[model samples]
Target: MPSSFSSQMLSSGGLGLAAGLSLIVAIGVQNAFVLRQGIRQEHVGAVVAVCAVSDAVLITAGIAGLGAVVEQADGVLRWLTWFGAAFLIGYGLLAVRRALRPSAGLEAERAATTTSVAAAVSTALALTWLNPHVYLDTVVLLGSIGNGEGPSGRWWFAGGAVLASLLWFTILGYGARLLAGFMSRPSSWRILDGLVALVMLTLGVLLLVRG
Candidate 1:
C-alpha cells in the first residue's frame, strides 16, 4: 500500500510540473521583459529571483486554496484586469519608441541605457503582478489542478510546480546571455523591441476587450 501511494504521489507531482511548464513556457509580456533584461545582462539575478519567488508564492497560494478566495472577489479581479491592461499598453508604447529610435550597437551602448537596480526590480514586480492572467493561471488553474491531488498529494504537486518555475526562470535569465552575440546588432535589438511592443499591445487590447 505504501509503494502504491508513493507511485500516486509521483504521478501527481509529474502532472503538476508538466502543467506548470505548459502554462509558464509561453511567450508573453513577462517572458519578453525577462528575456530583454537577460540579453542586456542587467540585474539578471535579481530579475530571475523575483520571478521565481513570485511564481512560488502564487503557486503555493493556489495550492493552499487562496484561489477560491480570489474567485469570490470578482471586484478585485476586475480592477486588476483594467489596471493590467493600462500598464501593458503603456509599456508597449515605450517599446515602440525604443524600436523607432534604435540605440547604438552591443553591450556598451546598451549598458549606457541600463536602468537602476530599483527601476529594474520595480518593472519586474509590475510585470509579474499587474497581469490578471497570471493569477488565473497560477492561482485558479494550477490551484484547482493541484487540489485535485487530494490532501496527501497536493503539496507534492505544488513542489513540482514550484520547481518548474525555478528551472524556467533560471534558464531564461541566464541562457539569454548565449544570444548576446545576435542581440548585439542594432537591427536585432530593433526586431526584439518591436516584437515586445506588439506582444504587450496585443495582450493589453485582449484584456480590455475581453474584460
Candidate 2:
C-alpha cells in the first residue's frame, strides 16, 4: 500500500479505538471493582485482559446481530435493569460505609493469596456478563454505531474497540499498584470509595427509574 494509504489506515484505527473507549469510560460498578482490583495488584493482568476480550466479543456480537436480538427482548431488558439497579445501590451503600468509617489501618495484614487463572477468568466473566450496562453499551449502542459505519468500517471499528479495552485494562491493572503506593493515605482511598459509591448509587437509581 501507498504511504498515504498506510497513514489513513492508522488514522482510522485511532478513530475506531477512541470511539470504542468512549462508550465504556462511564463510572460504573464494574469499573470501580476493576479499579480496586488494579490497586490491590491482584490478578491485574488477567483481569484487564479478560475485560478487554469480553468487550471485543460483545462488540463483535453486536455487530453481528445481538443488538437486534436484545432490542426485541424488552421484558428481559427491564428485568436486567432492575437487577443491575439493585446491585449498584447495594454496592454504593457498602462503599459509602467504608469511606465514612474507615479502618484505622489496613483492615487485614495478610500475605497476598495466589489467585488461580481459572478464578481470575471467572471473576472477569461475571463482571462483564452480569453487568447489564455492558450489554446496553456493547450490544446496543456500540452495535448500532458500528453498523452505521457499514461493512468496511465494521472490522475497523471492532478492532479499535478491542484495542482500546485491551490497552485500558493493561494500563489500569499494572499501573494501579504504583498509584496505590503514592496514594498510601487512608483519606485517598476513602475519597475514591466515596466517589465510586456516589456514581454507582446515582446510576442505579437512574436505571431503576428509567425501567
In model 2, state the lDDT of residue 83. 80
lDDT (tens digit, per residue) of candidate 1 on 55-119: 99999999999999999989999999999999999999999988888567776557667798899
Name the candidate that leads on lDDT. Answer: 1
Tell me the whole-model lDDT of each prediction, alpha carbons only.
0.91, 0.75
Residue 133 in candidate 2, Cα distance off native in Å: 2.3
lDDT tens per residue, model 2, 26-70: 666667767877776677777787788888899889988799999
Best by TM-score: 1
lDDT value, residue 157 of candidate 1: 91
Candidate 2: regions farther than 4 A off: 1-12, 106-124
